[model samples]
Target: MAPTCPSEVQERKILRRSRFGCRNCKLRKLKCDEGKPRCKRCSSFRVLCNFMPNVPDLQPVTDDSSSTFVVQGRAQLQPPLTSAVWTSDASTFYQLDAKCQDFVTRYLGRSLITPDDPNMIKVNRKLLILAFTHPFLMHASLAVALAYDRHLNSSLGCRRTVEECYHRSQSTTLFNRRLGEPIETRDKDTIWGTAAALVILAFSAPDARTPEESWPLKSSDPSDFEWLRMSRGKMSLWSIANPLRQGSLFRAMESTFAEIHSPLPEKGIDGIMRPLATLCHLKDSSTPGNNPYFNAAHAVSQIQDLLDSQVKVGQTELFMRSLHGPFESLLRGKDPVALLLLYLWYRKAGRSIWWIELRARVECPSICSYLRLYHKGYAAVHAFLPGGSLAM
Candidate 1:
């Protein structure tokens, strides 16, 4: 070829030697200004400010992407390396479903109830107990909805429906009388369950003005009040179980998650175990048919099984706060199911802790309610039965 122009010759020389583009521009695939010290693209991007020398005077920067590099063979950079950044934009509900299948499965029977079905009623009653007494589930939107939905299928319909029942029950002032007429009138188990359910409903009252107060009745066993002493110590049953034993514990734990279906920290439930233990005491000691303390202890021990193989932190907290009032009553020695009723009342009132505790303290007073009821029941037994004194 004829003599090439100097500028054209230089351009050909640089372009011919390069593979894709300049090193800095190739990583980002951007246009290079080809400035001295650093290319304009690299400088604008705030990348490393370095120039590739035409001749090898100084060693090229070491490829220490994996290893730490020492400056002057003495010290290393404080942080190691810069990796690629990641980003995503996805649907929350989709992510929630993907992550929280286990939580959804726990309330399957309760949440999927059909009206006019006996099984549905039983499931609703059980779920009501769980929702009314579960502190963690009560606090979360998803958990509460899941547990409450189960109740809806059994007898109630939805959040709005439950609120309507709460209001209607308020007008009756028999907020605890779901089986008010006692259809069969003679099944002890049914009677006991109804009594328990009514007791729980007392706690479920939405406001002092509506139902007026906590349940007027009290538990008839010392075991119910005894759980408060256990609360003073560390490591409640909720703390001891890795995953927990009862299925109900996981009822409302789906929507309130941090990452997609990620497991929560193991010790997450440890803080609330004492309170839960107290709830078990109230539930167990409602009647005198068995050693309520032992029964309560056994029920609480099963809480470990209630946890999924893996737990989520946010969901656990959600379950705990939702049922805090019932658990707290367990600590203070209220009737288990009755306390659950109080929980429902709080639930109806949007589950306000201040309102629940305030009404409970005003209505139920303290642990003395259960103690007095037990003493009265004990006296009644001795006064009426021939060998009551020797029955123990």
Candidate 2:
């Protein structure tokens, strides 16, 4: 027998760089941006933006978890539909089974926006219209709604279900694809909406079932406490989207964002707890640039003020946003001192923020466990936590 040649041994599959690119870009011989609503080049060139992912009308399926739930009990994502329509405005298209379609239509808006705030009603409707037009936004909304549903309805602290992860993966793919392209003015709110939803998802869903498996007490990885990084990333979108700018529908969230983002005092930690102050090593001489803990310290101080005022609002993103890299790294690296500071903040934040109470259910206890197990000598610092002696 002749020796087989390497070329004959294996046949390579040739790949097309523009596999999902729009026809106009392929015609113009340019790489398509592959974003939704319209690709950047098509939007700039002012032509019909058409491509293929064409979904044949999905024959309406009966109500069943077979299509909507996990393929197995594992957290594996559902495979996407292969074909889609030529003229649809969204990025990816697939049929939601009857149960999912109904859930999204009925409970999704309420899961996201508070009905108590009359202003949020308009925000909810506006987002629904945008979600219809932008598939990435739609998936992001679904992921959030599903997670919020589980949070509200679960009898115990439950792990994220596979269905939630599927929409999250889909939204992440399309959202990142759009972020890479030349951002058109019209796509700003859509982009912002998706970013905001993902931020909520990040905060609300962690993989662990109990505090022992949560951050600090749990093992560390590059992605641990991802909510902190996500909060920072969403803030960067503000310059691009400028939700408060005239004619932007997202301006409806302005009061909510503004409420949590009240400026730090001109010069002190007046509202901050003395125990937290000492834990942070804050001094009259200390300023943000000089002390790594300064910003985290300042943030908790503001939270203290909010709690004292009996403000009913709650978006604890303030803790993540106000942190500088040094302090954030300390938290990510699972430093006891850093975890102690966070414990203090978490205890205070949970008092008023019902949503944060869900996270504190795991993390706050984990911090106490970690301190009790490893840093027993730091009795003074650990005292700030629940069951610890040092009261704030």
- Please, what are the lDDT tens digits per residue for candidate 1 over residues 1-392? 02222243222123222353355464333455666666565545444433462311111232332231112112233432334211111100011221123344454234321223454456555544433222112112223333344343533111223222322222122212322434332222222322323322333332222111223332233433221232222123223321122443322332422322333222222322444434334332243233233322332232333433233223223333322343444435545443433332322222222212323333432222332343334343232122333221
Q: Please, what is the whole-model Cα lDDT of each candidate in the order they appear? A: 0.31, 0.66
TM-score of each: 0.20, 0.73
What lDDT score goes with residue 30 in model 2? 70
Going through the candidates in order, what is the number of backbone clashes in each?
44, 8
Per lDDT, the best of the predicted structures is 2
- Report the number of the highest-TM-score candidate: 2
Cα RMSD (Å) per model? 30.7, 14.1
lDDT of 2: 0.66
Cand. 1 TM to true fold? 0.20
Off by over 4 Å in 2: 1-91, 111-115, 259-261, 305-315, 351-355, 389-392
